[model samples]
Target: MQKLYSQGSRLDVSMPVIMGIVNTTPDSFSDGGDFFSTKHACDHADKLINAGAGIIDIGGESTRPGAALVTEEQELARVIPVIEYVSRHHDVWISIDTSKPAVMAAAIAAGAHMINDVRALTEPGALAMAAQLQVPVCLMHMQGQPQNMQANPEYENIIHDILTFFKARIAACIAAGISFDNLVLDPGFGFGKTLTHNYQILAQLAQFAVLDRPLLIGLSRKSMIGQLLNRDVEERLIGSVSAALIACQHGANIIRVHDVAETMDMLKVWQMTQTQMIKQN
Candidate 1:
C-alpha cells in the first residue's frame, strides 16, 4: 500500500481512488460551463462526493488543446470561491488544477489539499510555491503548451520520455523541499499525444510505478476515447468507464474523471474481483 500525505491528511492508495473533475471553465473540452458558477460547481462537487469521489479537482482554466490563456485574477475568481465553498462544507480532499504559482498559493490558502499541475510545475515559481505549500502535488507531463500541445505531438519513445520527465521533476521537487511522500505523478494523456501515443501510454501505464509515487490518470470522455469509439463527448460514458477500469488494472492509484458515479461503481466491482483473486491465490 502507498500513502499520500497532504496538509496533514493521509490518503491510502491500497485501491485506486477517484479524483472527480469539476471544470469551472467555459471552454473545457467536456462539461465546460456546466459548473461555471460557484453554486453550480459546489452542487456538482456534492454529487461527486456523494458518488464516492475521494477528491474533488477544481480547475479554473481550460488546458484543452487550442485553449487560450486566462489571466491570473480571472482564474483565481473562477476557482477560489468553489474551493472555499467545498472546503467549508465537506470533509473531502480538494485538488486545485492549475500551473500558475499564484493560483496554486491562493488555492492552498482557500483550503485545497493538493496541487494538480498539467505543466508538471515547470512554469516559473510553481515548484517553489508547491514546496512551500507542503501539500501533495501531482506533476503531469505535457510535451508542449496547451495552445499547441496536440498540433504535432511526437516522441522517440513515448513511455521512456515520460518516465524521464517524471524523474527530473521529482528531483526538482525534492530539491525545492517537497517530501517524496507528498508527490504524485501523472502521464498527461491527451495533452500532447497522438492516438497511437495515447494508447501506448495506457498499455504500459504500470511502468510508471518505478518512480515510487502514486499515479493519477485522467481518461474520462477524452478525445482519445471519442476518436477510438466514434462517440461524442456526452456519448463516451461507457468508453470512459471502460478505460478507467483498464487503468485500475494497470496499477493507476488515482483516476481523475468527469463521470464520478459511474467510475466509482466500476472501481467497486474491480476491487471486489481483485480481493477474490487474492484470496484464491
Candidate 2:
C-alpha cells in the first residue's frame, strides 16, 4: 500500500483511486466547454464525488496538443472560484492542475490539496512554490511545450528516458525542501508521444514503481485512445475506462480520468476479482 500525505489529509493508494477531471478551461480535449463556469464546474465536481471519485482534479488551462496558453490572471479567475466552492462544500481532496507558480500558490491558498503540474515543477519558481505549499505534488514528464509537444518527439529509449527524467525531478524536489513522500510521478501519456510511445509506456508502467513513489496515470479520453479505437471524444468512454483498468492492473496508484462513475465501477469489479483470486491462491 502507498500513502500520500497532503496538508493534513492521507490518501491510501493500496487500490487504484479515481481522480475525476474538471477542466475549467474551454479548450481541454474533452469536456472542455462543459464546465467552464464556476457553478457548472462545482456542480460537475459534486456529481463526480457522488459517483465515487476520491479526488477532483481542476485544470484552468488546457494542455492539449497545439493548445494556446492563457494568461495567469485568466487562469486564476477560472479555477480559484471553482476550487473555493468545492473545497467549502466537500470533504474530498482537490487537486489543482497547473504549472504556474502563482496559480499554484493561489490555488493552495484557495483550498487545493495537491499540485498536478505537467511541466514537472520545472517552470520558473514552481519547485520552490510547491515546497513552500507543503502539499503533495504530481510531477509529469513532457518532452516539450504543449503547443508543439507532439510535433516530432524523439527518444533513444522512451521508458529509460522517462525514468531518468523522474529521477532528476525527484532530486530537484528533495533539494527544494519537499519530502519524497509528498511526491507523485506521472508519465504524461499523449503529452508528447506517438501512439507507439504511449502504448509502450502503458505496457511498461510498472517500471516506474522503482522510484518508490505513487504513480498517477491520466489517459482519459486522450487522443491515444481515440486514435487507437477510431472513436470520437464523446465515444471514447469505454476505451478510457478500459485503459484506466489496464493502468490499474499495471500498478498505477491513481487513475486520473473523465468518466468517474464508470471507472469507479470497473475498479470495484477488478478489486473484487483480484481479492477472490488471492483467496484461491
Candidate 3:
C-alpha cells in the first residue's frame, strides 16, 4: 500500500481517497455559510468522518473567483476552533487550507496534520513556514489571484505550462528542505481555468502522474459542472461525483469534495469492480 505521512498521520493511498470539504467562510462558492460557525463546522466534520472521509479539509477564506480576501486574524478565528475540536475528537487527518503564513503556523499549532495552499506556497514566508512545519503540503497551480484570476485566463499549452509550473514548485520545495515524499500536487480546477481548460485537465490528468507525486483533484460542484450542465449549486451532486470518479480513473490519488457520503459510496462500488477486473486479468 502507498502511504503518505504528515506530522505523525499516515494515510493509505493505494486507491483514490476522499478529503471532505469544510469551508468556514460566508462567501465560498459552494455551501459558504452552511458551516461558518465553529459548532456547525465541528458537526460537519463529524458527519464527514462517519461518511468515511480520510481527511477533513478546512478552509477559512473563499478562493472562488472575484472573492475578497480575509484578514489573517479572521482566517485564524474561523478555522482554529474547528481544528482543535476535530483533533481532540476524531482520529482522522486534518488539512488546513490557507495561503497565509501566520494562518498556516497557527493552524498546525492548533493540531492540523497538513497544509493545502492554493497559492502553491508562493506567498511571502509561506514556503519557508511550510518547510519548517514539516508536514505534507499540497501545492496547487493558479494562474493569478482569486480576485482577478478568471478575468481573462490564457495559456500557451495548458498541460505543458502546468507541468512546468509543478516542476518549478517541486524543485523549490525540495530546495527548501521539504522532502519529496511530503508533497502533493493539485491542478486547481476552477480557481482560474475556463470550462474548456477544466475538461482538458481532467481528460489529461493521467499525464500528471509523471511528476511522481500524488495528485489531488478538487472539481466537486465547481463551475465546470454547473456551466456545462446548467445546474445550480444544489443540483450538481451527480456531476461532481461523476467528475471525481473520472479523475480517480485518470490517476488521481486524492479527491477533495463536498459530498462525502455519495463519493464514498461511489468509490466503494468502483473499487470492487476494479478488484474483480484485476483478478480476472
The lDDT for every candidate, in the order shown, is 0.92, 0.93, 0.94
| Worst 10-residue lDDT window, candidate 1 | 5-14
Clashes of 2: 0
Off by over 4 Å in 3: none
Candidate 1 Cα RMSD (Å): 0.8
Clashes of each: 0, 0, 0
lDDT for model 3, please: 0.94
For candidate 3, the per-residue lDDT at 25 reads 94
Task: Tell me the alpha-carbon RMSD of every candidate.
Answer: 0.8, 0.8, 0.8
lDDT (tens digit, per residue) of candidate 3 on 1-281: 66788767789887998999999999999899999999999999999999999999999999999999899999999999999999999999999999999999999999998899999999999889998999999999999999999988999889999999999999999999988998999999987788999999999999998998898999999999999999999999999999999998999999999999999999999999999999999
* Error of model 3, residue 200, in angstroms: 0.4
Q: lDDT by residue for model 2 over 1-281, one digit each (tens)?
A: 78887768888987889999999989888887899988899999999999999999999999999899999999999999999998899989999999999999999999999999999999899999988989999999999999999998999999999999999999999999999989999999998999999999999999998998999999999989999999999999999998888899999999998889999999999999999999999
Global lDDT for candidate 2? 0.93
Error of 3 at 266 (Å): 0.7
